[model samples]
Target: MGSGFSVLLPVYDGDSPEFLERSFDSVTVDQTRPPSEVVIVQDGPVRPELTRMLARLVDRSDVPVVLVEIPVNGGLARALDLGLERCSHEIVARQDADDISVPERFAVQVPIVEGGADVVGSAIEEFVVEGDGGLVRVPPVGHEEIERYARFRSPFNHPSVVYRRSAVRAVGGYEELPLMEDYWLFARMIHAGAWAENVVEPLVLYRVGAGAYARRGGTRLLQSEVELQRRMWRAGMTSFWSFSRNVAVRGVYRVTPEPVRRRAYRAAVRRDAEREAHTDQHTDQPGTTDAGQD
Candidate 1:
């Protein structure tokens, strides 16, 4: 693959100007490799702020900004595929309108993309606003370990990923799976024996509820999990026993004692916070306006 790269940002109604501004801030660009293009796909009717943000970004950045507006909302996969087709570079990065990338995210990941991994993602930290001058922290985990633990849980947070345009296209880009498009893509990638690796660094600050996770109800989330199990089984990456174990663990989480469950959730969140802080030490400030390069 060549050194140049592009970013595909799929925007929707609720995306705010502040979020987009912050997203641009996190990418660390250098002269060696700068983002050649940023394709922002508006899947449906856009909010006033979102429109204003797009205008501002197109005007301010040196990189080319291509805005594609679709009359009807077809879903994320379709919007992403539309962006993918328009990309001109060899390396493509994914960003959600609401999720914020860490500074140096692309600068760090692009080199790995050349190392032959079809998909290169990283550990992630997440945050939820708390009352009165406070934010909650989420921790980072190892992807290899997470895959090993996937028999009982979903360990990879897909938003914090950067993949090769060719490898993803090889898997047919994004499929019409249940809800988690990233997970579905991962299943197919692993099944095809595509080389995918994860950097230990936490390169993205994924906003949970307001971003990707809130699009569905609880029933849909459960169904999506079940669907992933079936896909993995069919792909031969996971055995029936592993699928059953994952489902059983999720069921146990549902019926566990309140205090114990609360503690577990809190502990998990605290760990994420610690991991974010640690990764931040190696990264630049989160609010700078330098786009990433390949």
Candidate 2:
């Protein structure tokens, strides 16, 4: 409701305590402009270790955290829907349990979203299983490029995204799309004539591993892609050609050998030397030491 935004973070059993702390700190306390509040959704029953970690984080964090645990494992889309409904702010930022955000992530995005953008996301620094792994930067900046890029791939990083509360609600919140919930929501938002933009800089450290890749590269994904593209084509957000392109390209990636897929994945994202270089210049950068993160 105020100038500050609400961060929506959802987690499950597999998330580590290290990831939970860094992700929570990056959004709640370790930023130039911290959030007004945080709405963390427990998708379902998590491991006991994760429960203890959540308790420790909520107990230690200065920001107000509202925990909403569902009765059972409702999956990400339903969890996010509940979180979005509980948010009191007009602007909502998305934070993944295992990723880290730049200290200035909110400071940079709030102004642009306040200006006129319905959805504003930044490029991300993609790392592998280990936090210190190599980085990869994605392309397309500004609303125009984002719209263009959406035809082939997800233009904005999901964890690095912030959306106008009303804009997302008007589109019926997030849907239970197999592996493309974020991208599916983006397309629906665009089809509804929402204005979207992508900041050229990296704002979040995106974590990926075999698990993340496996989610996106299963045979089940073909059906997901088909359904998503059908919705896109029916909504007029994607053309027949674009629909075919998405299925073809994404299908190949899913069917490719694991090693080749990993290579391709690495090729799609870029090194975060830029974010690291800027860290030395900025005094307020977040120092997420590996200490106690485990």
Candidate 3:
């Protein structure tokens, strides 16, 4: 197994320079096991502030930072596909420009990848501010549980994922799917028989605010949801009834009011107390499957 991994981060014009710096710091200076290199894709012409910030980050980084410039504004899928091509290592961990990874995130995930998992992800904590406590979104752990959960929802936290480049490329990297690109790629990987797992611990701090909730709803997202469901059905990842159910349920969720959507989203994640209770119930039990926690 290779000892080094690359960090793939794509930044666009709208991203805040401050957030980007923090993100870069988290994966580089702050990490216990820093990446061998960081491939930053400038999805388009960013603002002057972001441009300067990128220059400073590269200058300050101890590890190599590869900057790939896209002349025009392409979507996240395109940016990521292009970035993946530039990554120098077989193991590539994803990082979002606006999110912060825990210092030990890579330390905990890289070993699992070396141990034979094609893809590994972890729970994420969503926060409106930098220091405030946040709600944790925990996905199912273990390969079988991940495969079963993929039929209903995204099995991995895209920003928190560490995957093998060959596995992702063999399944044909990200395709254009608006808001559902990550889910689409993951679904394809899962269907292609990738070995996947998720850690119960939250490994990244996901930024969530009014904009995040607002983006979740809207006509465009509803349309994306419909198309995603159709693709999943055609791909044999979901049964006919499952596809229909997803369209009806997720489609409505997309078009609902932002406040209602926010409540629904929060309801799906666990609070600190709930997480502790769940850990107590599921951890260190004899002959018990990790699926019981989900």
Candidate 4:
């Protein structure tokens, strides 16, 4: 398989310039299998500091860096769709503007995509502070398991995925789905019969804190949850019963109090991490002990 790949990263005004620098360095300077090019999509007008940082990143980057600018602030889904068009390689790896990818992330995922998987993602380690203790969020490993898991929750970590550009474009790229854009696109890809898998190892350091949990709740997200469920049912990706169950369960989570939601989210992540650690002991899989949630 060709080692050439493009890293698609989207940044907005809300993103910290410091975090963006770390994220960019992780995918470019720190990767064991660095991307051939990096595409940074300016979702909207950013702070002056961010603009300067972007200029600096481009000036010092060893690989090609393509900057796609949007005059107005568009949401993540729209920004990603535009950025995907500028990607110059068949293979594309996603990187969040605030996350840190492990150096070997692409080294392991790229080969799986070349082996015929249309989409490949890995688990992530969610941390509030870099190098601090974090939980690893593990996803199901096999394609069949991933398909089954998608019926209830997201089957892949958005920022940790490496996929063929053709597969994503064939599925209609990313539609404007509020906060659930990644899940929506993945569901459509699955319905379109795209092969998918998730590496159990934690490959990215996902930053999570009070703000992250707070954003997960609220009326806007609840509305998006309902809309996403409706779209999934209309597309025949979920049965009527599944749709009803999801609307009831996920909807409640979206509207719950932020503190309650945060506790529940962390608890679930801890359980998954413990379960993965136990499984690793019995199997020969090479991975870390703690797991994270996404």
The RMSD (Cα, Å) of candidate 2 is: 8.2
Q: Report the lDDT tens digits of candidate 3 across residue range 1-294.
A: 348999999999999999999999999999989999999999989889999999999998998999999999999999999999999999999999999999999999999999999999998988889889688888877787778778888888899999999999998899999988999999999899999988888999999866888998899989988999999999999999999999999988998898899998888765533754565576668876555345
Q: Scored by CA lDDT, what does every candidate get?
A: 0.68, 0.81, 0.90, 0.90
lDDT of 4 by residue, 1-294 (tens): 466999999999989999999999999989888999999999989999999999999999998999999999989999999999999999999999999999999999999998899999999989998999487888776777688788888989899999999999998999998999999999999889999988988999999866888898999989999999999999999999999999999999998998899889888878866765665664554553322221
Query: Which stretches in model 3 have alpha-carbon errors above 4 Å?
Result: 271-283, 290-294
lDDT per residue (tens digit) for residues 1-294 in model 1: 458888888888867778767776454243234577888888888878778888887788778888899888888889988989888887888887766676677878888887776777776655554112223433233344445544444445676677788888888888776567777777676566666666665677766554323343356666777777777877777888987887677645545555665566667657756754555553555754221110
Better of 2 and 3 by lDDT: 3
TM-scores for all predictions? 0.77, 0.87, 0.95, 0.93
Q: How well does candidate 4 score on lDDT at residue 189?
A: 94
Instruction: Tell me model 4's lDDT, rounded to 2 decimals.
Output: 0.90
Model 4 deviation from the true structure expressed as Cα RMSD, one decimal place: 3.9
What RMSD, rounded to one decimal, does every model reach?
Answer: 7.7, 8.2, 2.1, 3.9
Q: What TM-score does structure 3 among the candidates reach? A: 0.95
Candidate 4 regions with alpha-carbon error over 4 angstroms: 274-294
